[model samples]
Target: MALPLVLFDVNGTLSDMGRMTQHVEEIGAPPQLAGLWFATVLRDGFALTAAGENPAFRAVAEGALRVVLAGQVLNRDVDDAVAHILTAMQQLPVHPDVADGIRGLTAAGFELAALTNGAATTASGLLERAGVRDAFAAVLSVEDGPGWKPAAGAYTHALAALGRGADDVVLVAAHPWDIDGASRAGLRTAWLNRDASPYPSAMVPPDHEVAQLGDLLSALRT
Candidate 1:
């Protein structure tokens, strides 16, 4: 059998978005709101997807940040705060385990690609900075897809772009929604449960679960 292509979700899956909290503090907003702001961005983005609208990631992120920063006392204006946070996202470093994990998967002869809701350039820059950009066959963005993920069209777009069948791909992500969406789209899924949080009851269970990205090698071998 041919090895299944590994489709990685780039944000929280490969990159360490938690560092945004530090940027939030540096910009004079409550650090904790960084998480809330990101969550709100996803919430609204998903809502837009469900409504048949596709908003750019940066647009949604900046709008959500403004809402989150409203009424908060910041050293800079709200626009500056939003710009600082978005800039921080663009410069995010990949998680420590990601490079080795990606390298291992590539060494094992499985094709790899990055499927992100954000700009493809962001994903490319992140992997390049981590020294693993060459491992990916492609860096994809929802901007080029039919819609953001969890929408069937997005997964279909990726499979078509890769010239592979859904059954020949595995979607790896840290988010339950991403896993659930891929499962529903007829692809295998591996959930990177770095936080050990319980899976959402409403989502489909992942085929594999690991606390770290490197653990996926062992998980897939079995």
Candidate 2:
């Protein structure tokens, strides 16, 4: 039987966001603000989506960064600091398990693709930098979709773009919200629970759960 197409979430799931803290410090902001700044970015994005609008991820992120860094004692101009951090985000490296996990899945004959709330170019750059760009059939961004993940239309848009049915695609993500969204859209979900945290009770449960990406090879095969 042909293996299902696996759609992966790029940011926190595949690429590590820990590098953001380093970028934050490099720009003279408190390293601790990195997490909060990211959270604010997501919050604004979701707000825009909820209001029936889809804004570009870079715009939202840059705006959020400016607000987050406004009161900070930055070594450079606030705009320069924001630009530096945003540049760092674009060049982030994939997680340690990503290379092996992607190779294993490809060897198993499963097609791979990436779907991100950020720009597709960023996703492509990330996989390319990690030497796994060719492994994906496509790298999609929410900018091309109806809205971001946690919205059913976003997954449906991706399925349509990939020329696959919802049942033929499986969404692999670290966020329960992404899992829930894919599940509601009639796609299978695999939660990459690297942190071993409890799944959110408010969302649908994932069909498969693994502590790391490498474990997905076994999870999908079975």
The TM-score leader among the candidates is: 1
Candidate-wise lDDT, in order: 0.92, 0.91
Q: Write the per-residue lDDT of candidate 2 for residues 56-159, one digit (tens) a residue.
A: 99999989988888778988987788779988999899999999999999988899999999999899999999999999999999898888877888999999
Per-residue lDDT, model 2, residue 185, is 96
In Å, residue 75's CA in model 2 sits off its true spot by: 2.1
Model 1: per-residue lDDT, tens digit, 146-215? 7899999999999999999999999999999999999999999999999999999999999999999889
Model 2 gets an lDDT of: 0.91
Candidate 1 residues lying further than 4 Å off, grouped into runs, are: none
After superposing candidate 2, which stretches have Cα over 4 Å from the reference? none
Estimated TM-score per prediction? 0.98, 0.96
Evaluate residue 104 in candidate 1 and report its C-alpha lDDT on the 0 to 100 scale: 88
Deviation of model 2 at 206, angstroms: 1.1
Specify the highest-lDDT model's number: 1
